[model samples]
Target chain A: MRLGMFFREALRSIRANAAISVAATVTALIAVFILGAFIPSFMYVRSAVSAQTSKVDVDVYISDTASVKQVNALRDKIGTLKTDGQVAEFTYVSKDDALRLMRERLRDPSVLDELPSNPLPAKFNIQPTDPANANAIVAAVKDDAALDPTEGIVYPQTTADRLLTAAKFVQWAGFALIGILLVAAVLLIGNTIRLSIFARRREVEVMRLVGATNWFIRWPFMIEGVICGLVGAVVAVAMLWGIKVGVVDAWASGADTALTKTGSAGGAIAFPLLTVVLVGAGALLGAVGSGITLRRFLRI
Target chain B: MARIDDDIHDAGSTPRAFTLVEVPLETVPADLAVVTPPASEKRRRGDVFRPGPGPMVQFQGVIKRYDGDVRGLDGVSVSIAAGEFVFLVGQSGSGKSTFIRLCIRELRATSGHVIIGGRDLGELKRSKVPYLRRAIGCVFQDFRLLPDRTASENVAYALQVTGHSRQEVNRRVPEILALVGLDGKGDRLPRELSGGEQQRVSIARALVNQPRLLIADEPTGNLDPDTSQGIMDLLTRINRTGTTVLVATHDRDTVDRMQQRVIALHKGRIVRDAEGGYNEDPGDTGEIA
Candidate 1:
């Protein structure tokens, strides 16, 4: 028999079972949607992790009574921090500058002028090369007698701890959600294509009896499964992009200060590539699911 | 229409074995098995395409069974000449269907070689089964025509299954349909036709490829005497076309009346072989056609 004729017959069989095809498509759509929902959640979590990580720094307050030579020695250490692999940034503020900043923050314009001989101390602001070690770097600075009670050290320890916890939570949660969606997506398309194969088992058996090749029988279903998955992914991406742009952005721009306080709450969803990955992945996942179902039940 | 033989008449038939009378018609399953050709008369139509001989169908000491232990055909063998017509008759479950199925490679012989047209059916690859079947036209008693397809479609399907292009299939299907007396019924589906017509459609399917060997399994077992005569006439006409015919049936009327080579089988062994008088016209000897 003609290869073209057999494929045409297969296409006709698939068409005749319109209800099954639609059911499979709907199943694919839902499977892909569930998978797509997890994509942006992962991106948002990643973004949160990065934003929180960027806030970590080490602060070193110098004593006003320190010798000029000692202060200059510490300045040299701060300057070589990058090459030494100890710090990311170093900012130094003199006693006069510190008093002026405190005066401004204290919101008493006359406080700096009233201070006797600039009571505030000079300080070196240090940021670690890695956010993870910011607290350790601060502790090290404070352990030094001259940098301890005399000058003091400051670090955003509480905020860093909280942000690290949030980041870890997001990472684990996103990973766990992705794993579940993968299986669910496979099973979703698997059952759908299984029914598709079941619907055409008669034709399949006929073709088998007639000596048609296994690939000749299976390629169409594989193709159909992939196409169905792509459609599902496309729908999901559109929905995700719409939620990201039309709704989230509009809300962010419209006096949503409270929403913005969650560290650019809506900005984390800009991931265009991630959406493509999710959609493209859905198609691949569909192919794999089809492979399983066809292999298992199509008995090819 | 092309004129066929003169002896295919109702009164010219012979005794039929295991008719509907024997098999209770009170109520059978929906899938009524219309197995026509009985598998008696072991004629090993000699080696086909021998480097020095004409084509033949040959079987050498063939044994067959289902469970590999229960004997189907027990060490039986025979040779049949090319272009000869023969009939096989035996009791129910006497390995008639098994014999033909073995020749077609639908079932393999346990201990023998079945060779046809220079190709060994036993040794042919699984993929080559269709190609092998192309040279052999098989007609079932139940008329295994696709019920959903029209008469021409049913005939065309046989060719289509053998890789005939649309042009060749369209041409040969009509010719064969006409040959089977289904000329104008090409558009009629199997169910739309009478039982005899359905069997004729099957015959048309069998004849579509212009096969060298026509294996009919009770081609008319389902029809009444009159209708059965029509079917026998069709097969005889097919046999006259220089094609070897192997018919397995218990309808002694069609076989004895026709006076073709009769190979009688009793419990899987040949009991009778009437030959040489094959071409003697029934009219000259007062015998059935």
Candidate 2:
């Protein structure tokens, strides 16, 4: 029953002090919106980088002079070198299969047809358990005597490194932005609560004289703060959902955009999870910000 | 009742269980017949009354010093028994406000102890201040009513904060408002009420909790002589119910007419303490009516 009264009081105060309430809510909305916008984009970049890195593998090309027995021996040797499950799996591609894959990938059959014969070599694709360990596995394979007849080993080192660096930068920048925005949101809410408390200072004094407990005086203001935060967060989430459906989905359907590709590959956090996070953050900020600001006024 | 008093004194080592009783209502003077008979009976049996051994308020060598060596109260000692109506009269800056503030624990004395209802203000913790304040009702010169709240809400707020049920608050608010003669004005905001009506609402708010002590600071400073008389009469009625009433005022005429115990202060010191009027001038009768 007391909680119900507190809620009624909070609602009434919010309605009565519209200016401060709106200022706090709008500030919270902008902060949460900025946070919501950055989080998914950051997640998308990180996931895309990880997906690309996972595709990194060493392709060992076999020379035409190499014997079938030698190739088989190399395969057995590579299988034996799988210590602690460092190498995940391996597959063998024949010359004809490689030529077929090239033709399919290039989408141009004329170039392949002009060749006198299939100059493509059979290759063994080695998958490492961790993309970070791919280079080490490649070195081990190259140093082995049985793989002496290999033509070359290819791994997209430079591209993977660049993508990982970019992902790291995005992660740092996202956290920094979120930290700054959270401080701004807290300050805005605190200032708004301070103004409301100042306006009702006489009432607070009366409450004190009446033997009201400190929590009794504080709970209503805290509830009001939470309402402001909840409203702001709800609006921010609605805007984010609208943008995702209207702008992002439309652009993705019309043209193959990076965001669309990331969305397909589960590059960002789930929508429901993001909603919970934003809402929870909003409530926490409001409760804590106002709770701390009310300390000075409650001294009366 | 004697056993309870004995237990309280023996339980002094365990402060949590110690309870102070107020003065009995039978001690009220016979001439103050304004106290309703039923109310006095209720107070006699009600949980609100707890008769104790000491005075309602005791100031022992109290001294208050502000910054730059300014004295608010200098070596002033006084005691007010329960159920007594006393007037605190002095010029501005003569420690009238300081005396009231000290009783409510709003400001600590620079030296000496202030005991109210057998509890020392100096020993009270910050967390326990609210409990201390709940035992005392306070009124101000400005009436301090919330501008947005109706008079009923202003009065109900006193009960609500002390954890009274909604039904009890609803029942008691109107009763107190009626006692203060604000029967139908409970719905009016502070701005709508006259200054006298607003002060009465404030008084009702203060009295709603049935506090043992009521301290009014310049309650009649803003009212005309007639309205001030009405407020004083209401206060006297409250006092007759066994609540110790203390009024700090600059009104000479009310002090002279009421003939209550008057304590005069000058430069933070008690210049006079007698049962008469504002000043202890020659040829002024000191007899109570």
Candidate 3:
């Protein structure tokens, strides 16, 4: 059949079954809407979580008796950890640099200037690639001979552990919610199409008796499904854009919300790409729902 | 009880074995046995079906069993030649519908063969069922027409679905609609037409392809007697054009008036097959035992 013929038939069917068609479209819209809205919010939360975790770092302090060669070896060990993805980066603060940093921090510069021969010890500030990896990084270097015996390494272990747990929860819960919603959407859309097809099953039977091939009969229905999907997706994307502009943008612009404190919520979500993905997903879901539901009816 | 005992004796083990009345070619009236020209020899507008040489439909001990072991058709065998008009007469549960369904390969026989136009329907691939149906026009009691389409579009749909070009569909649609006595009613939807007119539109759609066989399961079941007569007359006229017509009906008066070949089924078995009125003598045909 001609492409135009399929479209004409599909349009005619959609008009004839307007109520069910609308139901199917609305089903797709609701599904796509929820999924689209959740995606950006989840991304924002994940970004904020990572930002908080990025602060947990390992601090290695060296003893004054340690030789330059031992310090150099420790620096090389940190470089190896960086390559292994355990450490994000390491910066060395020599005794003189430490004394200068301390002098800058003290409001009374004369107090720091009274110290004789810079009594501060050198240390290496180590940032782990992941907050949960801070404990591992500290464990890897705490036994090294170049470090001080007493306060050799210091990391906010309790804070990193709690942040890691919270981050894991956020990631898993977000995925579970999206997954459950997706399955529910598929079933709802499929049921609506099933009812629609059931209403017109006699039409299909007559077509089969009149010598129309299965694909010939399937084309118009499939096209109708695809049209519903595309329309629903476009509507969902538009709604999501409205919410982004009206709700999210308004909230982010306000004074010092927790989201704004993280400074990663606004301007970070890709609205254009999200629109494309949501539309594509809507179309795919619509097509699959109707196509599979039509199988049992076509056997006649 | 006697029939059951006889069936067991004849079949040795199966209690439903039936004796089919085979209508010998010589027994058929000379005029009704007229040989139709091969489809390729006389190609005309909308005549796409090419029926191979031999009987148009043959059922060899075909048995159909529904769920719960209820026999729909049991050990039934019959053959219908091309270009003949036959009436299938039976009660509601006498397997008339099952026979028609088997002819279209809509139901498979349990252990027998249903061959159509020299092709075994049992072996016809599932994908090819539509092609098989294309060669056989079918009508029903309800006049199955698309409610949204006009009569002309409904007839055109049969050709359009098979990828016929616009020029072919346009030409054939009007001709077939006119042939079915719906010349000026092409633009009317099914709901706008009377019961008889709706059935005519359905017949138009069915015969638009000019199939080799036409099976009507109670084509006049919903119509008044006068309208039913008109529809039967139309079917007779179509049969005159060399399309084998098989109609299953409960209209005894029409069967008596037509005086066509009648096959009577009782309890899923053919009890009589003879060219006469509805109450023709069963012994005049094949042996029942």
Candidate 4:
């Protein structure tokens, strides 16, 4: 019953002060919309980078003079190589399989037909369970002197290094941008709630005089703020859904870009999860902003 | 100066020894006896006027100093019995508002003790201030009604905030409105009512909780002579029903006409404390007689 009264009072105040209410709701919608748009893109970029890194492996080529028994033994040893308790998997490709793969990748089979013999060597592809452990796996392979007959290992060090740098930059920049925007949203909501409460300070004084406890006087205002936040979040989520379906999907259909490929690979945040996060952030911002603002005005 | 100091000291010592001043029933006006609650219900509620030996309000050498070293109440000591209708009369800047604010615990006294219903306000925690205020009804000159709400809602709000049941609020709002002589005006908004009617609504709001004490700070300051008289009569009737009433007013005519116990202040000091009309003597300085 008390909660009902509080909500009634809050709704009444919201209607009475329409301009301030709209300003606060619109500010919250814009802020939450920006946050919603940024987070999925950030998640998508992170997943795409990690997917590229996971494809990196060390290739151990077998020497032509090495016996089949030696090659099998080296493969067994590479399979046992583990980093952080994660075993490496070895895929042994024969010389014929390598030649076949190269032939398929090449646009013209006539150039490959000019060679006197297949020049490609049989290699074992060593993959770590976790991409972050690739360096440790490579070090272990290099330390194995028993595999001396094998050709030198080939690890894409430059590509790995560049991917790591890009991931770190994106993570830090995403956090900084979200932090600035969240602060701006909080300040705008707080100021609007403060103004709304200031206009009704006389009513608050009367409530206090009539023996209303501090919480009793504060509940309505806080609930009003939460309602504003919830409305903004719902609107922003709807807009985000429209953009995702209309803009992003259309662009993806028209072009085969890297982003589209990543999207097809399921690199984006799930819509349900994104909606929950955006709505939760919006509600939290609204409640906290109004709660803090009421503290200064309602001294009862 | 020495005589004046002695008189102030004498008034300060009266409450310490628990002196009760009995005013005969015939001395009160006959017209103030219209509405009286039944004796059985009054006893069940344990009204403050249960022939108790203790004073309802006690101030022991209270000193309240504002910012910039200004004195709001300067070493003032007085006591009000449980059922007394006392008038706190003074000109502007004379500590009347300060005295009332201290009673409600709105402004803490810088020194000395203010005890209401046998509880020391200084020892009360900040969280308990609301409960303390609940025991005292306060009516202000500006009425302080929420302009957006009807008079009944304004009165029901007081009961609602104190956690009364909705049915109880519905039951009691009209009763209190009737008691305050705003019987049919419950549906009217504050702006639609006259200044006097608004003040009555404020008074009804104050009295809805059946507080032990009612403190009116110039409740009729904005009303004309006739409306002010009606408000004073309502206050007198409310007092006669066993609720202690303290009125601080600049209306010298009403104070003189009521002829209740008047406690007058000048420059934060109590100049006179006695059963009388408003003190008009210019030569008298802090003299009780």
Candidate 5:
């Protein structure tokens, strides 16, 4: 009977304050939709940043004290051992070839021409199995007696570290924005429910005078709040879905495909999923916020 | 101040000391008005303060002030017995409503105690207030029924608040509405019902809980004389059923015709509390005299 009474009252409040309930729902849906859409983008950006930071092209230089026959033998041996985890690829780089490649990259044509009789060393351009395996690859090479220790191996560690920090920043920023949005959700819900409850102060006072428990009075308002939040979430999700589809399919025209390999698939469904999350988030937030306000203002 | 303080000192020296009701503005003080039996003040040494047991509710040296601590019930002492129908009659600013407020735990007396059912209400714990409320029903002038709900819903609301089950609410609600002659009008809203019917609905809500005491603060304040008579008749019926009914009104005819106890408050003091004033004609009940 008590449960029925609460439900009946809750339904009455919702029906009575139709406009206010709609307003609350819309706010929640939009907030949740936005949060949902960004979550995918945030995750994608972090992963892309991670990939960039973790991959590198590496090269190991072999010295002249090592004879051609010995160096060549070592190269051939290391090339076959690539499947064993040390080397991703092993190929010989002749002094002349190295100079030529340097001229192409550096645009220093004069330096390449003045490479005194193949001054550039014969290098084994070795790509490690993984970027993280660079140091291990270097150590494995060092254990060999044939390699020169002076300029044994090199990988751009500093660039990788910077990229990692940038990825972390993107992830954290996404999370921070999500936190702010949730707070906004609660505030929106609180104001809406407060207005609805305020409209029927006499009704609430009468309830209190009758010895109604605090929650008995609060249940209907909280239920209405949750419904509002969910409705808003659904609408927001639809809007977000439209945005995602429109941008990728319609707006993506004349856009650089060379820029995005994954296309809208990168964050297409995330918006709809985001809407779902927003709805859930909105409902939870609305329920809690309404509870607090109702508890204070309504004596029961 | 000097004369009053001197009287207080002298009264304090006596054994039957009836001092002021002392408490905060929120806690309803128990005040017993020491009524002299016409010969006791001149004869007895200790019986000066004790008015002798007469009723359950008495205002003893009670005072009430609103803003700037102005007194509302000052040194008021009157005894109202259980099952007594008392009419609190006074003019505007006569502290009639203040007396009711004190009686129902709405406002506390500034000095003296306001006792109810042998409980010194000033000393009752705050959490137990709702429990105390369960024992007393309050009916207001505006017919404070929830407008959005139907008549039965409003009456059922009273029991539901006390966590009554479906069967109990269903059983008691109809019985109460029937008692107020609103038996079949349970599904109608307040606006749908007439003014008299609406007041009856309010009465139905008040009586649904079966409170030991019924306090109607101007129950028919908004009704015509004919309608007012109807409400009075309902009260008389309830009183006949053994519940003490304290009605606050400036209605002379209603008080006069009932042959009930009348307590008149002038400024904050009880100027009269007696069996008189009801034997007059049953005319002009709504006109403030």
Candidate 6:
């Protein structure tokens, strides 16, 4: 029953102070909208970069004359590296399997048939825990006794290095942008709430004189703030959903651009969950903003 | 001062009533005769000061010094028992407002003590000020009504903010409004009402809580003579019901005509305390009596 009174008071204040409420809501919307758009885009970029880095690996070849026991020993060493948290995993490809993979890649099987016998070397494709750690894994097993002398180990160092660098830059830039946007949103919304409370400070003083507790006076203003925040977030989420459907989806499918191709290959974004988080964040910001701004006025 | 003591004869044997009863000012047990005790007789720091019986308001050598060393109240000692209608007469800077503010605990005394209803305000916790204010109804000159709320809503607000049930609020709001002579006008907003009607609404709001003390700071400052008279009469009627009413005003004609106990202040010090008009001695200098 008391909650009903608080809601009624809050609704009345909002209606009476419609301009301030709108200002606060718009401020929240701008902040939440920017955040909603940035989150999925950031996730999509990170996933695409991760997909690229996953292709990095060190290939260790076995000599044609190496004994089965020698190959087993190499596999055991790779297993030890995995257990030590250096190697992610390793796949052993026999010469026959390598030859069959090449035939599948060639335009004509006749080209491979002309070889008379398989010349492809059997190798263990060892994935590293981090793409940046490829060089360390390569150096660790490059001179192993069981490996072929001519093709002992091979890894695409330049590609892995470039991908890792770009990923690091993107991650840092994303964090900085998000931090700036959040601070801006909080300040703008808090200022709006402060102005609204300031305008009604006389009413608050009268309430205090008439025996209203600090919380009694605060609950209505807080409810008004939460309403403003929720409205802003709902509108921002709708706009984000529109952008996802009308802009993001169409741009990704309209061309074979690097961003669109990778985004599509990485799978769909979790927009429903992201919207919930954005909405929750907006409401929390509103509540905290009003709660803090009211402290100075409640000193009576 | 001796004349005030002679005028206020002992009527302490009368029983106190919790609700409003229309008794005349003469029957109010004129307890203003209890003069401030000397320094040696005053309660010490560790002692609790509940005046002889129970004065609704007491200020013992209360000194309120603001920043930059200006004194809002300087060594003002006064005691007002329950159910006394007293006029705090003073010019703009005479500290009448400061006294009222101190009574409500809006400002603490820089030194000495302000006791209300046997409670020493200096020792009252900050969190407990609301409850202290709740027992002391306040009416201002501006009729501080929320612009958006109707007369009834404005009055109900007092009860509502204190967590009273809606039914109790519904029952008490109209009763207080009718008592303050705002009966059928409860639906009107402050803008729709006259200056007099607005003050009536303010009074209703202040009295709805049924506080033991009612402090009106220039309640009639904004009203014309006739309207001010009506407001003062309503206050007097409220006081007759056993609530202590302290009106801080410089309204000469009403103060003279009412002939209530007048505590006149000048330069933050009381220069006159008697049962008389606004200026019993107009030529008296602004010095502590």
Question: Looking at candidate 3, what is the lDDT of residue A28?
Answer: 92
Model 6 residue B170 lDDT?
Answer: 79
- How does model 6 score by TM-score? 0.81
CAPRI verdict (incorrect, acceptable, medium, high) for model 1:
incorrect
Poorly placed runs, candidate 6 (over 4 Å): A59-125, A129-136, A144-179, A253-257, A260-269, B1-18, B21-53, B280-289
User: TM-score per candidate, in order?
Assistant: 0.65, 0.84, 0.81, 0.82, 0.71, 0.81
**Taking the tens digit of each residue's C-alpha lDDT, what string does model 5 give over B140-175?**
889898988899999888877766667767766776
Question: What's model 3's overall lDDT?
Answer: 0.81
Q: Please write out the lDDT profile of model 4 over residues B31-94, one tens digit for every residue.
A: 3232222222212111121112478889999999999888999999999998799999887778
Ranking by lDDT: 6, 3, 4, 2, 5, 1
TM-score of 2: 0.84
Off by over 4 Å in 1: A1-7, A50-72, A84-86, A92-125, A128-145, A149-202, A205-300, B1-93, B97-116, B121-123, B133-149, B152-165, B206-210, B213-225, B242-289
**Chain B alone, model 5: TM-score?**
0.76
Q: Judged by DockQ, which candidate is best? A: 6
Model 3 DockQ (Cα-based): 0.57
Per residue, candidate 2 scores C-alpha lDDT tens digits across A120-168 of: 8888898888777777777777754434254677877886677777768
Cα lDDT of all candidates, in order? 0.66, 0.79, 0.81, 0.80, 0.69, 0.82
Show model 2 residue runs off by greater than 4 Å. A61-65, A81-84, A93-122, A145-152, A156-176, A262-264, B1-51, B280-289
On TM-score, the stronger of 1 and 2 is 2
Candidate 1 vs candidate 6: the lDDT winner is 6
For candidate 1, lDDT tens digit of each residue in B136-172? 7788877766555688987776656545568767766
What would the per-residue lDDT of candidate 5 be over residues A19-116, giving only the tens digit for each residue?
88777777777677767777766776766666666466566777768887778676766766586876777677877788778788895578666645
DockQ of predicted candidate 5: 0.28
Q: What range of 10 consecutive residues in model 4 chain B has the weakest lDDT sum?
A: B11-20
Clashing pairs in 6: B21-B241
What shift in Å separates residue A130 of candidate 2 from its native position after superposition?
A: 1.1
- Give the C-alpha miss distance for residue B98 in model 1, angstroms: 4.1
lDDT of candidate 3 over A202-229, digit per residue (tens): 8898888887778888888888888888
